[model samples]
Target: MRLWFLIPALMAAALGARDANAQQVHFDIDATLPVRDTELPYTLDLNLTAAAPTRIGVGALLDLREIQKIVPERMADNAIVDNCGLQVRLDDLSFQAQDETIGLDGGVTITIFECSRTSERDFQRGEQKRAILANMSTQATVDLRNNCAYFKLVDLTLTAPEAQREQLLEDDTLDSVKELMLAAVDLVLNETPLCPELPAELASLDPVYENGGPKEIGDGGLGVFLDGSVDVSPSTILDILTVLQQRKLIPGPP
Candidate 1:
């Protein structure tokens, strides 16, 4: 069957910043993301590639033990999932500051095994909605140049029961759905704003998916190879630092 997957606000709780000591920052966010939209416009397959190879993923995204860290436990609490019995969970979150970019990386796993009904009538009729579980890793870099951001999808692994996998494979539906989901992920990641306007404040720091942004992609493994950049404000660094402080990710002024 043709399915339009409505991805949750995977970009909502994600934000990062850097200081002089780029390697000294740490943040962790773990929660179940709710899927609200079930219908999405299908797109062609993604051609993913990496701009420049880096060995950053070798040891772990970041070292949380040595550096000050922040973990937001309430990010996925308000996600809407009334239609599809779907949930997206993000874990192993970490961030770092490089010479020119702020990197946010984490693992996102989508599971749709649950069955739910829209209303009492639907429940009585035995009508149910379900989703598939997909495990994916995401890396986003905020470009200090031209005030934009870039995103890369890595290690995208889809999982399902043997029966389900076989059925979709036999019908050629699995490949189609996987492609669409990856594209949707890439679109959401690149379109979401990374930096705030000058003189950043809590209210103005709201960065969500918006149009009229620059994006690029290249070919890679299992619909995972992808990358794109966006422009950001100069004050974004400071704003993010302030946000971290406000969110208690880092220690506040004594």
Candidate 2:
């Protein structure tokens, strides 16, 4: 199954109206999911407290290799202009999260194929591979209607190699290249869906909103928090079970 499908399935299974008179219900999930598409394992944890307003918290540790595959795709979608007649590629991507900031380290290869004044003087008609590093802080907004969360880029700082930095200082084209890198990172974080939309029946149980943005978790993972409310009636439980059954996540009555 897709990672998206598995995420909501886990959430649905964990949700319950255990106490009718209790004002709150808590859900805690800790699992390691093997993403078939990416051929990687993701560690996921979700903690939710539901009442008049539910509070949801999630922590996820992602494989950098998976992100490496996505960055190029998102970069292509941006249609970044190559005024410098340069072809760029990224590889050996690594990540670290601390103090609510994610640090990205990778190698960038720039191949100069055509003639440009700067390239003619400073660069050869070949590839120049160098280390590329960046740090970005992230924030999240909850879309309760869609039962998902959207991450936003809070701040970003790109650190280029000395040669590239010098080029950026002199050439407008290099500046565009820098912008392209930032745009690629933005697309990766903002466009990718961290949380899949839950079914309508599940979403309707509570009124949800953002409690806080994503923060640094254990090792190099990201954590997000959301707040909402729920009504744990027998009908509500039945509705949830029916949805799970319809999705074949749980067995129907024998």
Q: Residue-pair clashes per candidate, as listed?
A: 16, 3
Off by over 4 Å in 1: 1-126, 129-131, 137-145, 196-254
How does each model score on lDDT? 0.34, 0.43
Candidate maximizing TM-score = 2
For candidate 1, write residues 1-254 as lDDT tens digits.
Answer: 11121112111112222222232222222212112332211122211111112101101111122221323232234321222444455545554434323344554444444455667756322233344443333343333234333444542444555756776578554454456556666666565423322222523333332222222222111111112322234354355446556766556667
lDDT of 2: 0.43
Segments in model 2 whose C-alpha atoms lie over 4 Å from true places:
1-84, 115-147, 155-168, 198-207, 231-234, 239-254
Per-residue CA lDDT of model 2 for 116-212, tens digit only, reads: 3554456334333332332222233323235445544444344566756676567554455556756765565454454533335555445344443
